[model samples]
Target: MSETTDPDLDDSVRIADPSIDTDVIDRIESALEEGALADGPEVRAFESEFGAYCRTDHAVATSNGTTALHAALEALDVEDGDAVITTPFSFVASANAIRLAGATPVFADIDLETYTLDPADVERVLAERDDVVGLLPVHLYGLAADVSALCELADEHDLFVLEDACQAHGAAVRGDRVGGFGDAACFSFYPTKNMTTGEGGIVTTDREDVAERVASYVNHGRAENGTGDYDHVRLGHNYRMTALAAAIGRSQLERLPEFNERRRENAAYYDDRLADLPLETPTEPDGYRHVYHQYTIRTDDRDALADGLAARNVDAAIYYETPIHRQSAYETVSTAAAELPRAQRAAETVLSVPVHPALSERDRRVVVEEICDYFHNQ
Candidate 1:
């Protein structure tokens, strides 16, 4: 947690680090040594290992996180003209994937504490709308959403639950992994994520049917599970993860626990140091293990805080400065019946500081000192 053990933190404090090392290099070399570099042994091994880690029966790899979600929604039978309920506080891709699946994203406000979909708000919306066929709750900033409540709502309304676990690779709730909660959960392996495959995604599920559907849809809609080439059963996309990326992913996946633990340590440090400050620190609800992808803090003067941190060489970032409904791309199809005050307030007030594993003790102290100086001196 400090520079004594992590010497590289002094170099620079970034929001995230890929943590690539000799192991990743060796895996890439091994993948190249083999004659197969396409969706071959490495991809299969990654899927199997990742699925096992998440306690899911099947894990389907894709080109990226967005495709994973799009495929998940489609595999769950979210048809055209259907509406999917989701929070407006997440990354744009969360809502965009619903659109890619030919469904309208119904925006709901988020809970102030978790920055996730408000279950009560969701239930209120469901009671009023009949077209909502699914619930797509994002585990934003690496915290598990209220999947238990969302799952209950889904069961009560016969709706599908597809967790957006892109930022929450190893996060859990009540001792269960976030990826294992919903019908199918999507994970991102982008370089900035908790784990990286250069650029990759996966769909984890216990349902054999969902696994089979996502597998086929991601591979040109051909019949999967050893089906011969040119046997196209349905229209699909070529969203396959390369063997090289898969190899990197497997190596990263192996180190995910360590990475998440280091992130937690960093987050705890920030929480303790910044407790008395006017800004609100991140929260880990009861029984939820939050893998801190971004240690986001909320303050009314977020711009000033970000500016001050940057001026002092501390990298601070704002995730989603604009909500999805406010974004121009979603203005056409996105619907909002009730006021999304929490989401809007969060967009205006939140700022993420460096909490990545690579941060050094010196870097941590610099961030803490700078943030305190900004508030106390003013």
Candidate 2:
């Protein structure tokens, strides 16, 4: 990181959002001309490398993150009316994917400190509906969900475990990577994510059938066999990744580990400097390696604090103002049966500070000082 300058005195304490634009104008153009721009060898290469990185036996590339989640559900054969338990404190795709897969998304309250699905709440849901076919635990803000305990509970209930590791690329729990923690893990390569493929995703798993189903499903059900060249093996989707997107992703993947490391360093600086404030810094458990995708903290006076930061040209904002279960899109959901005091409170108070790899030391210091000033004035 760079050194901090006073808001009134310095010129470039401003932080730039980190992400690489697809500079392969030539590659994309050439591929488009050649008509080999669809899900070709480039996508295959990305999937193969990504699978190895995740320590999974197979990886299926998809058109986007949501498709990746839907494919995972379909691969597991999640049925209509079957409940797929997950956290409401995450991106809408977590629950929307379940609904799209013909299952009801059973939302559980999140742990206040980690903003992940609370295991106890999961147990509560399971106690009532033991027919849950899958559990999609999201590793929010690059912090690993309590996978060990969650897996234990899933095993107890005989439910399949899937990981929504979209925001947690390169993040690990107890030395095991997020993709390896569940029966299958889904990753997003969206532009704002820690890493990107321009626009694509990868689904990792160890099961042969699941991998095959995912491959066929994403490519118009083309089985890797002879006869009926356009044969449809299973009810499938045209969710294949393009070669151009995969090419960009290949470059991005090479840089992801270092990018995550920089995020961790910025988080450590915030953790040390913001300790005296009313906010609670994100916690990285002893065995968990948090990549600090957003470096979020909670303040009782969130709006005032956010305004203060904005006045200084520091862009801090709330990630989720409403839990998924409480959203108008899901108001009819039954997951809100019990009071979600934790999720509601987190929604009110939590705000994310910039923690992208592009931050300079000066940028980080300014952020910390402005936050400190917010507390002192209170």
Q: Could you tell me every candidate's TM-score relative to the true structure?
A: 0.96, 0.92
**lDDT tens digits, residue span 2-105, model 1:** 12224444445666656786777778889999857768888999999999999999999998999999988888888887999998889899999998888999
For candidate 2, the 10 contiguous residues with the lowest summed lDDT are 1-10
In terms of lDDT, the best-performing candidate is 1
Q: What is the number of backbone collisions in each predicted candidate, taken in the order shown?
A: 1, 6
Q: lDDT tens digits, residues 78-116, model 2?
A: 998799999989999989999999999988889998999
The Cα local distance difference test for each model comes to: 0.89, 0.84
lDDT of 1 at 74: 81
Candidate 1 lDDT score relative to the true structure = 0.89
Off by over 4 Å in 2: 1-16, 21-35, 225-228
Task: Indicate the TM-score of model 1.
Answer: 0.96
Report residue 323 deviation for candidate 2 (angstroms): 0.3
Clashing pairs in 2: 1-361, 2-360, 2-361, 2-362, 3-362, 4-362
